[model samples]
Target: MARPDKVAAVDEIAEKFRGSSASVVTEYRGLTMSQLTTLRRSLGEGASYRIAKNTLVKRAAENAGLDGLEELLVGPTAITFITGEPVDAAKALRDFAKANQALVIKGGFMDGRTLTVAEVNQLADLESREVLLSKLAGAMKGTMAKAAGLFAAPASQVARLAQALADKRAEEGGAAPAGADADATDATEAPASADASEAPASAES
Candidate 1:
C-alpha cells in the first residue's frame, strides 16, 4: 500500500473506532486466506474484520479515546468492530474460533468498557438483539390478552345472575296466595243443606 493510502486507511479506522459500539481483538496468526474469508462472511453486515498494523491501531485507539486498548494490539492481531450489537460479533468470533483454532480471541471492548476473555465468551452466549425484541413483543401481547379476559369476567357473572333469577321465577309458577292465611282459626265454616248430600263413596270406601 502507498504511504498516502495507508494514512487514509488509518484515518478511516480511527473514525470507525470512534463511532462503533464495540470491538474485539483477535490473533489470526496461522489462519489461511480462505479461513479469513469464511470468518468475514460469517460476520455479515453487522460486524467487520480487518488486519491493520499495530502502530496504526494504537493511533486509532488513542484518537478514539480508547487508549487502554493499546496493550491488546500485539502479534498478527486483527480486529472485529461490531457496529451493531456487541453480542452478535462475539458469538460469530466464538463460532469461528471453534472451527479455525488459529483465529484466537484475545479480548474486547463493549460500551466503552474493556472486557476480559471470559466476559467476551459470556457475551457470545447471549441472544441476538432481534430475538430479545421478539420475546418482549410476545410478552406484551400476552399481557394484553390477559387484560381483555379480565375485563369480560364481570359481564359473564351478571348474565349468570339474571339466568338464575329467571329460573327461580319459572319454578314458582305465580302461585303466591293473595292474603290467604292457612293458620287462621277465626274463619267461619260453611254447612250443607238437606238437598246437598255426599254421593256414595266409590268402591264402598
Candidate 2:
C-alpha cells in the first residue's frame, strides 16, 4: 500500500485501540472466510473482529500508547476490539475458539495491563455484568430485610411483655383494692375513738 494509505490505516487502528475497553489478539491461521464471518457475528455488537497487517497494527499500538503487544503481533493476527463488556466479548472469543480450533487466543490488554492466554480464558469464565449486578441486588435486599427484623425486635419484645402483663391482670379478675381502703379507714376511726374514751375517763377522775 501507499504511504498515505498506510498512515491512515494506522491512525484508524490507533483510534480504535484508544476507544476500546479491552482487546484480544488471536491467530486465525487456518480459518476460512465464512468461518471468520461467523466469528464476527458471534461476537455480536459488543466487539469487532478485524484482520490487519502486523506492521500497521504494531505502529497503531505504539501510537495508542499501548505496549507489550509486539510479541502477540506476530503471526496471522486478528484483533478483537471490545468496546462494551469485556466479559461478554471474552466469552464470545472463547466459545468461538472452542468450536474453531484454528482460532488461537494469543494475548490481550486491558486498563494498561497485559494478559496471557490463560488470563484471557479466565476472563471469559466470569459471569456477565447483568448477572453479577443481579446477584448484588439480591444480596443487598436480603441484608435490608435482616436489618428491618433486627430494628423491630426490641419493639416486638416490649409489646409481648405488655400483653402478658395485661393477660395476667385479666386472669386475676382485675378487681380494685376496695378491702384495703376500708381497713385503712377503720384503723383511723379506732385511734379517734380511743382518744375520746381517754378524755372522758380523765374528766371523771
Candidate 3:
C-alpha cells in the first residue's frame, strides 16, 4: 500500500475500533467469496466485517487506544467490529464456523478484555439481546414492584439494553425520549451506535 493509502486505511480502521462495542478477529483463509458474503450478512446489520492487513490493524488498534489484540492479528486476518449486541454477532460467527471449518474463530475483544476462542463461543451460547430483552420485559411488564429490584441488580448491561429498547419503542410510537442518541437509528432490532453508520468494508487479503 502507498503511504497515503496506508495512513487513510489506518485512520478509518482506528475510527471503527474506537466506535465499536466489541471486535472479533478471525482467519478466513480458505473460505470462498460466496461464503464470506453469507457470513457478513449473517452478522446482522450492526456488524462490519473487514479484511485488513495485520500491520495496519495493529497501528489502528494502537491509534484507537485499544490493546491486547495484536497477538491475534496473524495469518489472513479479518475482523468483525460489532456495534450492536455482541451475543447475536458471536452466535452468527460461531454457527457459521461450525458449518465451515475454514473460518477460524481465533479470539476476540469484549467489555474491555481479551477473550479466548472458547470464551467467544461461550458468548455465542448466551441468549441474544432481543431474546433477553423480550424475556425480561415479559417478566417485568406491568409488575411495577419488580422494576426497582430489576434495576438494583448487578446486570447493568442488560438493564441499559432493555431501557434503550424501551425508549426506542416509545420514540417510534410518537413519544420520543428526553434525550436519545440521534445515531441510534437502527432499523433492525439491535441497537446501533454512531459507529454503526459506517458501511461494512471489503479489502483484499
Q: After TM-score superposition, what is the CA distance of residue 47 in candidate 3 from its true location, in Å?
A: 0.1
lDDT of 2 by residue, 22-120 (tens): 999999999999999999999899899989999999999999999899999888999999999999999999999999999999999999988899999
Candidate order by lDDT, decreasing, is 2, 3, 1
- Tens digits of per-residue lDDT for model 1, 109-169: 8777788888999999999889999999999999999998998899899999999999899
Candidate 1 lDDT at 49 equals: 95
With candidate 1 superimposed using the best TM-score fit, by how many Å does residue 190's alpha carbon deviate from the native? 23
lDDT of each: 0.84, 0.94, 0.89
Candidate 3 local lDDT, 1-205, one digit each (tens):
4699999999999999889999999999999999999999999999999999999999998998887998899999999999998999999999999999999999998877889999999999999878989999887875866776676775887888999999898778774442244435443435454345443433322
Report the CA-based lDDT of candidate 3 relative to the real structure: 0.89
What's model 2's TM-score? 0.77
- The CA lDDT at 43 in model 1 is 90
| Regions more than 4 Å wrong, model 1 | 1-3, 158-205
Higher-ranked by lDDT: 2 or 3: 2
TM-score of 1: 0.74
State in Å the error of residue 106, model 3.
Answer: 0.7
In the predicted model 3, the residue pairs found to clash are: none
Model 1 CA RMSD to the hidden true structure, in angstroms: 7.8
- Could you tally the backbone clashes for each prediction? 0, 0, 0
- Model 2 segments beyond 4 Å from truth? 161-205
